[model samples]
Target: MTEAAELPPAPQQAEAVFGDRFPEAVRYGELLADAGVRRGLIGPREVPRLWERHLLNCAVLSEAVPEGVSVCDVGSGAGLPGIPLALVRPDLRITLLEPLLRRTNFLEEVVELLGLDHVMVVRGRAEEVLGKLPPVHVVTARAVAPLDRLAGWGVPLLRPYGEMLALKGDTAEEELKGARAALSKLGVVESSVFHVGEGVVDPPSTVVRVEVGESPGGVRFAAKRAKAARTGRARRRR
Candidate 1:
């Protein structure tokens, strides 16, 4: 096997972004460089720029999240925004949701090693967990899928008035424009594109924020939720 590339030192901005959890951030970076590459969760080429492109890029997402809210990171491959967000914000409860077993295993280990009591690793696709997992205040994703398709998976898992934050690149605005109709169908009352990280990271991270109203996943999801509630009531009676 090829040797893993060296993880670059955390940029000076990381200290300010991660605050007291800076050490944990460094440890996470090391793991991403080492184990993350070995397991094919992340490419070896990504190791050298892990801090600037990955960690800090995701960590600054915390600025867009509300205080003391629950968040689910969909398709949390290698736990990008979820783990980094957890490192910075202890107050926010985070669930790292990944469909693959190998990736979930890595996330579980990282959570344990970091002692991130606030973070949970769940293995399942976003559609599969819709009714099984409680809806959260916010759903986060990065490089998962197209904006419309991704909204279909992430929006239904949110509580009323919750938002879906997607970390995109230059195509953020373009995707939002293309997905506007799909977003409307998913009960997205408002949608926009914005950037985070500013001085913390050059160019900053572009994000597509999709906010839902009272009916988070639209009409069909409401019916599904009602059915699930009834099923739960029946089970309780049994």
Candidate 2:
């Protein structure tokens, strides 16, 4: 396993990862890396990990996103998978949904700095924002939430037959077990897990793809909101 201390700085490695062909992607990564450094979002020693572990890990989602499709990235802190995907596939329209004011501000600045016209940022929680937006062909997340909860949040915004691409670590099996009940309740029937970057230095990761069906109605929405609000309040109090 690559220690966080041994990782390359985000800017240098991101440039190497994107190469010359994708100028915009490279610029976006550079800007985000700089911002991360300024905000102390990641430790200096962890720079290399940001590239191999964070950026490249997120970029792998590109293979699963179909061509000329719309994607929504929930809880898109610093626009990891979404920005990288948008950079690679200009054809795919990406909406980054981030509730935190600070992160959204940073993402908007990064988008402008990179001149990414294909992306948009939404400032609200997924549960509140998913209903208002058009159904997207794909929904993606990285370390945002657990499998079942993420599916519940994602399914409502997904077009029928649309898929959820969730990035997970080695504990994927345990998470899947815990999420089974929640998955069934959300109408996500077929779920499969794929291992990616097996030979890489970092611990292997998995992509759990869940097929979304119709969303639960208004009552369910309200209940979810109430629970989320209570959880947030608790966290704040703590």
Candidate 3:
């Protein structure tokens, strides 16, 4: 059993949406409010509204997930969207992919404390871990990068035709429009904005959904890939 820490009361929004799952969700919230703050992953001021803003904001994205599939949360700092996702969807196999040791340590502990057997803590950036990581049906992220750059890192890690569901703020549509050129080259077949969690979370949650092509793959790092391509061309001529 996970030890409980002092926590703000679970937001009514959480109970309203999560229903019976509310208790377990609340436990996870307590864990985040304490450890996540002490570790600097969550700002101390966020503790009061953590349930509404952080946990619920992330959890509501579950509305976009198809049932029973593998999910990888890239750059899963403090396990946003990832940990909450695992807590809500016991069926999903979630990988919390984080490059930082301190954050991964917190993620691993949270998984252990919450007894989330379905969640895996992977410590590495998407660029370094893509080839080594198993291709998953969905790649989740929040505060990761702009649409174009995120595709560069995420598309290669997905199963062919899989999707990248990025939690963008209000700029989702604008970002999608701006990324068309990059998306074409990065194997993105479709890109759109989705508003999920209607009644559960106020204002709903905005997600940028990018679907990869049937044979999808892309550069791991933009600058590095460009340099490598130029070098190859120069070497061929020489």
Candidate 4:
């Protein structure tokens, strides 16, 4: 059994912890369990940790995400954060962008099975797709890439005032430091980190929220040209 299952049943405890958000969390938990069963992604014994590690881990970031915003979850595999976020915040429109064909298919099925109309799945890499779309209010990611690469993927898709919320492990601070150069290249100027629950897992989780800022003339012009060149190459290869 997963670690989460070994612990005592926490349904009531979870409800008290989440308050009004409990019902949705529980329902989504069921959906995740069902999806895992149908896809054989996890053994029946593994559902509990999947619920806690994947679902709740992502759900807590909802506290960091601002309300009434359009957000995109980059490289969303199996729709962890995006799907759970849609369940909790019915008002926020979430787009899940996945590059792999099979994963994208899985995401679509999960959304349909869960009756999540607020979630949309796009098939493409973030670097290729993010620039084409209009900037969104916020971007989220989990286990997709390192902080530096994630910043590169997310910054281009964010409005000047938009935010990027990344679910990371204990090395979040170190990753943020490593990502400083990349962030500057992408026009992200400020960042904040928040630690989530303790003792749920080793090397506990944190959320890194990055804020986009105005790029200087030379930097902005250079970034635009670089993006254009990259897009051109991608189309040529296609």
True-vs-predicted CA distance for residue 201, candidate 2, Å: 7.5
Off by over 4 Å in 4: 1-10, 16-46, 197-204, 215-238
C-alpha-based local distance difference test score of model 4 = 0.72
CA lDDT, every model vs. true structure: 0.91, 0.73, 0.84, 0.72
**Residue range 27-137, candidate 4, lDDT tens digits:** 556655665456644456757576567766676676777888999999887776887778767779899998878678777877786677888899997666744766788
Ranking by TM-score: 1, 3, 2, 4
Candidate 1 residue lDDT tens string, 1-238: 6566677878888999999999999999998888888888898888878999999999999999999999999999999889999999999999999999999999999999999999999999887787799989999999999998898889988999999999999988899999998888788999988999989888899999999998765537555755797899999999
Give the count of colliding residue pairs in each prediction: 0, 4, 0, 0
lDDT of 3 by residue, 13-114 (tens): 777666666777887778777777777787777788777778888988888999999999999999988988887788899999999999999988888878
Cα lDDT tens digits for candidate 2, 99-190:
98888888898888777799999999877775578878899999888887777777677777788889988878788888877776666767
At residue 51, what lDDT does model 2 achieve? 60
Worst 10 residues of 1 by lDDT: 217-226
Best model number under lDDT: 1
Q: lDDT score, residue 235, model 3? A: 100
Which residue pairs clash within candidate 3? Answer: none
Indicate which candidate wins on TM-score: 1
* Candidate 4 lDDT score at position 32: 52
Query: Which residue pairs in candidate 2 have backbone atoms (N, alpha carbon, C) closer than 3 angstroms, thus clashing?
Result: 7-48, 7-49, 8-47, 8-48
- Lowest lDDT sum, 10 consecutive residues, model 2, at 1-10
Stretches of candidate 1 above 4 Å error? 218-238
Cα-based lDDT at residue 61, candidate 2? 70
